[model samples]
Target: MDSLSQPFTFSQRAQKLTGSAIREILKVTARPEIISFAGGLPTPAGFPVEEIHRAFDKVLSEQGRVALQYATTEGYLPLRQWLADQMTAEGDVVSPDEVLLVNGSQQALDMLGKLFIDEGSKVLVESPTYLGALQAFSLYEPSYTSIPTDEQGMLPEYVSSPEAAGARMLYALPNFQNPTGLRLALERRQELVERCAAARIPIIEDDPYGELRYAGERLPSLLSLGRKAGATVVRLGTFSKVLAPGLRLGYIVAPRAIIDKLVQVKQATDLHTSTLTQMAVYEVVRTGFLDKHLPTVRDLYQKQCGYMLDAMQQHFPASAKWTHPEGGMFIWVTLPEHIDATVLLQKAIDKLVAFVPGEPFYAGADVKRNTLRLSFATVPEEKIREGIAILGKLISEA
Candidate 1:
């Protein structure tokens, strides 16, 4: 039969998969003149190109064959040890054996889904959560229970609800959460961990933006708090935020049991992450490079966040409200209940400004269409001002 006449069947998983809303929006905003705030991309200016180049050169020069050769699925020993050390230093006692390197935290999420989720399993998440996590977990066809959230983050009291108590897992992005950019309060973190532990629900703490804090004092991670509460917290972290996303390097730290299972899943998936990239990253970060590098990143993000927030204050309608994030790349805006952000995006694009509508960030059908997300990490100060002004005018007119 001709290709056009061919009939094919697709798996239920494949059928359920939907394109990322932000990615779809990005295609329309690709024109240079469009001031796009739709992506969660880190500033290209923050990449340590020279240092990365030097590290890669050193790795090839000293360990050429080893760098190119296929390595263990568990990842390079030195990198895992380094990650374990860093986690331990951060109050979460971890061992190299408990660390599993993945292509990125995105892959970590997928593998975790494979490890834990089954068809129709219940997964608890924040009301307005990271879209990526929802996408990853949805592949396993889990029923989501979105917990009530606020400026301080997830409400611990909700975890006691019957739906939450019986969930297979609780997915959280506690430190500078994606889309919302809200950090969970310290007390809530402790209480959430304790409650989840009592309910026998594991937590997946995706902390890609933890190190990007600019204004507030650093709070203890859920992984660390989970330890005291006897919760099995699987923390996923990435070098993408601090270094370069093109490298696609991230690590997962968990109990030996979980790490062992995830390693098996990864072996079936991509075997292991690139050996050269892992070695190069280890070489670059081994000698306190991130200590110097991160401050610069934090400073840039802080300034950009300040610029966006200030622009919003000057341009936005008094009826609108938005999160003032202390750190991370995004600010969540809640427009008037009558204004749908999806419709606003099309209008904003006509004015050469674009932002992600926030409905897709939510897991349930009961999403607030008035919400949207703004990312400031890559946009210039002038563009931020210009774009927010345009968006403001559009909202006011609406």
Candidate 2:
């Protein structure tokens, strides 16, 4: 018999998840000359290395062995308290007891999947949703249904429709959504809160890029709205966008009952997020550095977005339709109907430019092949212009 056919076998859940296609494609675009818009990564210049170093030194000096020791499954108290306070400022009625510190918002999705999704649970997603979340939830074998979306974001009419009656959960990124960079309108937010409340379906509001807004008035978070409507909403947030991704610190704010279940699930997953990293984040937040740092990040990304937008206007074919986001990292581009972005990837790669194809973002095989996502967050201003020009040339020739 073959070694692979031994008695021992991987869990059914592990067998279900196919690894992220974007991550695999990114591996091919790692060359120094490749101008990539395939990732949701933040610029290296925005990371607070000095502040993190200072916090690390203080954590070691003051907390010593405690910083490296095993911590509670609920996470560090001060970190939880700080997160609660931050959410409170955003108008969310969050208590420390109702918050769970996760490794990343990504891990929170996994925990939610473990806690809620059964083998055949129905989950609703925005069309062209975040691929990473799709990958995270796929392990549970949930049936995904993609709902139609517009510039104002996911429409509320679909959630309670007869077709979506069996959906256990709906996932959305209301502000500065990934791939599309579209924000949910304030009116739609209220509509969704009411509809989901009446239907008794929970909403997972993921807002990793909300704080990276560069323009327009800041809108209230879905959690804040959900609280007012008495709806069940689990809000996931992260420091990866405004702070640093390496810290791997994120949080989920939900009902105490849900938090308790998720905490148990988290305990089985990784025991807890890093105590040292959590302490560093706690210290950094306590010192009020984040308030000062956020504006700088917004300013840098705003200029980059503008550069890319200008280049797109100059280079892209007139038939190509693209979104001009007010804030956040991406621009969603739709090519002529006959084009397939995945097929075009090899040609773009040959020109040292790469973007994620939009097909994988959809929940099913019926995807718009002409669409692609461009990220302006990681590339420099000059590179954004150059890359868009190159991509435009490829589009024109195609």
Candidate 3:
């Protein structure tokens, strides 16, 4: 038999893996004419190009040999210390020893799955959560328990249920959640942490967009609250949103014991994230560059989000409802119950606009097909208006 045609044995996990729904849509929307709200991409205009160039220059020039050499799997120390200090400042007292840098929050998610999940392990998650996280954790073949979630976030009362009580872990994206762009209510944050802690369930708090708030006061993170109540909360942070995604830098802050095991798992995976990249990132952020740069990014996103919401209000049907987020790149639209977003997406694509249908974001059978997510992060104000108008027309027709 020809090697290409031969049937090769594959692992059960490999056999079960499916491509990311957003990434597949990105392929169709790759056409220049398509106005895509399908991806979680940050605007390229927000990246600090000159600063990144300067940081790379400084690192390579100042320590060329060391920058190129292999380093410990724990990652660059100064970067770890900086992460620890930032967490401490955020009210979660952390030590450098508790930090482990990974390729991105995506990798951290995968490593967490490897560390904690076994086949049939019950993992709890929001009804509609980050699809990337779903993709990462799904590989472990764990059975997911979809917690009841809403605009204010997951219902804490559900944590007392038998499914949640036996869950091996609970995953959340509390700040400007990807699909819904909803923040967990402040009171629910503490109660959710306390409930899960009492059950001895580890909470995986993935916070990639925590700093992108455009309105309202910033709320305390689950990590901070969990620590106060003696709960096990592991936080995942990334510079992808604030800096640049191309750098592929993210970190995990957990209990020392968890960090120690994740370090071992990562060693067997990639040995370490790129040393040169870590050093360059440290060089850029060490000077408090994000503090200055992020304000401009926020202003631009707020304007773009406004344009989208305004256009939606003018063009969408009266029955359609959508989230009004204080921050983050997405606005989740909920159409009438009879409309299937997947079917609607094909029509939107024909009109040169694209969005992610909300079904795949759910972990269980109660998937809602009337929902879709629109991202305004990379779209210009004019394009956002144009795209929302097109989507609104299609949805109204549907």
Provide the overall lDDT of each model, using Cα atoms, as 2-decimal numbers.
0.93, 0.91, 0.93
Instruction: State every prediction's TM-score relative to the real structure.
Output: 0.98, 0.97, 0.98
| Candidate 2: C-alpha lDDT | 0.91
Candidate 3's displacement at residue 128, Å, is 0.4
What does candidate 1 score on TM?
0.98
Score residue 39 of candidate 1 by CA lDDT. 92
Model 2 lDDT, residue 183, Cα: 96
Candidate 3 residues lying further than 4 Å off, grouped into runs, are 1-7
Model 2, span 263-365: residue lDDT tens: 8899888999999999988999897888899999999899989999999999999999999898889999999989999989989999999999998899865
For model 3, state the Cα shift of residue 38 in Å: 0.9
State residue 230's C-alpha deviation in candidate 2, in Å: 1.7
- Superposed by TM-score, candidate 1 places the C-alpha of residue 281 at a distance from the truth, in angstroms, of 0.3
* Candidate 2, residue 21: how far the Cα is off, in Å: 1.0
Report how far residue 37 has shifted in candidate 2, in Å. 1.3
